[model samples]
Target: MAFEMFPTVNKCESIGREKHTVVADMDGTLLIGRSSFPYFALIAFEAGGVLRLFFYVLASPMAALLYYFISESAGIQVLIFAAMAGMKLSSIESVARAVLPKFYAGDLHPETWRVFSSCGRRCVLTANPRVMVEPFLKEFLGADMILGTEIGSYKGRATGLVCKDGVLVGKKKADALKKAFGEEPPEIGLGDRQTDAPFMALCKEGYIVAQNPEVKAVTSEKLPKPIIFHDGRLVQKPTPLMALLIILWIPIGFPLACLRIAAGSLLPMSMVYHAFWALGVRVKVKGTPPPPVRSNSSGVLFICSHRTLLDPIFLSTALRRPIPAVTYSVSRLSEIISPIKTVRLSRDRATDASMIKKLLQQGDLAICPEGTTCREPFLLRFSALFAELTDELVPVAMVNRMSMFHGTTARGWKGMDPFYFFMNPSPAYEVTFLNKLPKELTCGSGNRSSHDVANYIQRVIAATLSYECTSFTRKDKYRALAGNDGTVVEKKHAHLKANKLMGC
Candidate 1:
């Protein structure tokens, strides 16, 4: 059926991927001192419920028994439910309000801090009631809301009855999030117990921090991702591994494995290329809309402006549809470090012609016609690839807000390493799609030359992108406006001045 459902529309579309919360367990989690069992139970007891004090009273023995027979399960989870079952709603709220904070102090997981800083909002989901956990969260973590099992009460006295049918666990926690926040839940979820496994599943993305082997096993096979904890504050990126693999493979197998991987345009090799610049690289997009798959209707040969040592990657990531790219033969060294599929254009006429024919047949080709990256408003001469291809020429103009030194055009930029040009931490690139040229403009009769076609395409692209498009002689058709006083005075103002002087 190909049907898919998510907590929210934003989640369904990936717009809210970065704005979700991590729903985590407290106690053995974010805290390291005395367990919060006594406090949690006291609150539940006051709320008029059966106190399951066996976990608190006999925690060591019980944990030992489980470790020997079954597994070292989440010790905090057992005690929490016991506390809830034993309390009256009113009494538990009072104890929770008073004692939750004292136990919250400790070194929190570094992954949690990253989520807090990066995501839109962060939240805590625990079996403890809001009155007990709310104050600590607000004072320390500044959580948006708490989703926990609620106990009912009346007047000022104890109800002596568990109001909710069941404690929030597994499927119930997912229900709780949906009930509180509606169907569109947060992007991240975090928890410490097997009970929270279902709730974490409801979130679009987040991590599950398994404190012990038992909890890890409980959720291990069930969760979509492999459980990982924060080693420190920043997650260690896998770039170094990729770099090492490529460097090591060069000697072991020589160039054969690298050549095959590159020629096949395998996705894994593409990922390796990305890892090369992982330090400087960051994901960027205009929006997450699927790229246009139709034939190139808006054509001028897409002469994209190049910048950042990873311009090819930027094009691949930013443009919705895949683009054919033209590259210099010397730049092929990148195949060893990162596999990029490109049309190899040679300065030789026969070789260039064959490559151009292949690119035109492929439909969308990203031609860096300028041959090299340059400063804004200045562009270099168009390469002959433009002259050879007879298609709608669309100028794909790029204005680089930042420079990456690890690119093909950068000084000292050998093709061995990956350097990225990010607009910022979040890539905000400007990709202006210039208007396409009409076919008749270049197809006029017998004597039309490739240079003539190249010049015309060049001027249109220059005028469209507002770059100073010049020719081999360095004199553009627009040179008169480019501070050339002799040309401007002689070509433009001479007729006006002569008529005025003669009083005609």
Candidate 2:
């Protein structure tokens, strides 16, 4: 759906040149509480055809009664509570892990994704415990830093207690942010509750009140502009809403069905395939080459490029068996309902190696590997974490273009851009599954390290796509270049697209 509230930002204008930061509230701001929480419970309950929800439902009343008694009683209640709490943290986590998938799949607001696509550095400031929200954050929300309550750990299990000074809320949140970023921090903040009022007021550009009316009334005068959510959606005008809804919900299934029949196992990735078709972009498969040799019994490591924000969406729609995408610490904040598994990658050495190794052992490991998105042909250098994987690397190339009606730079490529994609008409994009590179090529042939494998992979990407090879180096520098006229170029492209669609 189109979110009209997000105003268009001109990259060529004065405001686009400035660096903007985003401070977003977790929980209700990014998540639809009852909808997501219970859905996860449902998914976990059904995994492996086991009715976990049936058990949880049967246990909830008793659990609730037990919890109630524990909360009220003085002597025996305390002992009972202590006994229940004694259950290992691992047990609770395991239960949560199983139940989370049901609630989280595709529950995120496109506006939030559009916001992330539109801004620069983003931080999540919340009162919720980090462990309770980590998977949602890591998989979809795209938060760079998780500012929340730190829970106690004993013998590697959660002690079911929050650390004394770690709760991130009220003045404490401001203190935590200042401590981490020093006196200066992000310029924009978003939230839906009164508790977030303080943090949102800290933004130089101001704040966006997410969903509640009561919170908005209180913060309206003291904070930056507050954004409110209505009808389970961002409160945007009607015209744009009609436009986006019309485009996204149109009937384009026949072609998708045809493509699926031809592709077989590859058909489930219909979302990716149909998006290009919807834009009338044609894919001329050169020829059906024999499948590449399978790697050492380990598994497949699907290392792909990040061409547009839709790449993963298409992958999720097409690739069967929940393919988890590896992302930076940032994406976790917005990816609340991501349908599959997601692994967080950190720059910290020990953590990075551990994550890479574990991902290789699981099913296919899907990674952008580029670290950042690029519209140009040259790929950003790949992180060395790829070399740690035991599986063979399958290089996937994503091909896309600026549609005539919709002309704008790609989202999340890098930089502090406030680009809202859903507000405008969307362009067409495509993902092509290319040949896989052997472990030797990805690991290094001879003395070449993983960086060499990265180089070879980048080269293959450049050869297969139509992007400008040198454009990757330009980065945000192009926003000021005299010859770079994105608006004019966009209009011309839009006109061309309209003509092509009409055969005029």
Output the number of the TM-score-best candidate: 2
Which parts of model 2 are misplaced by more than 4 Å?
1-296, 331-333, 402-426, 444-447, 468-504
- TM-score against native, each model: 0.34, 0.36
lDDT values, one for every candidate:
0.45, 0.45
Query: What TM-score should be assigned to candidate 2?
Result: 0.36
lDDT of 1 by residue, 1-504 (tens): 001221211222324436455555554444321244445433432233222333334343453355346642334344444455434444454444333333242234444444443545656666555556775565446577777655555565433333463445567767877886687767666555555567767766545443442321122222111111101000111122322332343344324333433432445433533532453334343323323435644322466665433455456555533565676643455654443456666678787767776556656566776665543354456665565556455555565443211122222334533322221222334555655555555543435566666666566556656755433222321232122313222212433442332222
Model 1 alpha-carbon drift over 4 Å, by segment = 1-301, 329-333, 337-339, 403-410, 416-428, 444-448, 472-504
Candidate 1 lDDT trough over 10 residues, lowest sum: 227-236
Alpha-carbon shift of residue 352 in model 2 (angstroms): 1.3
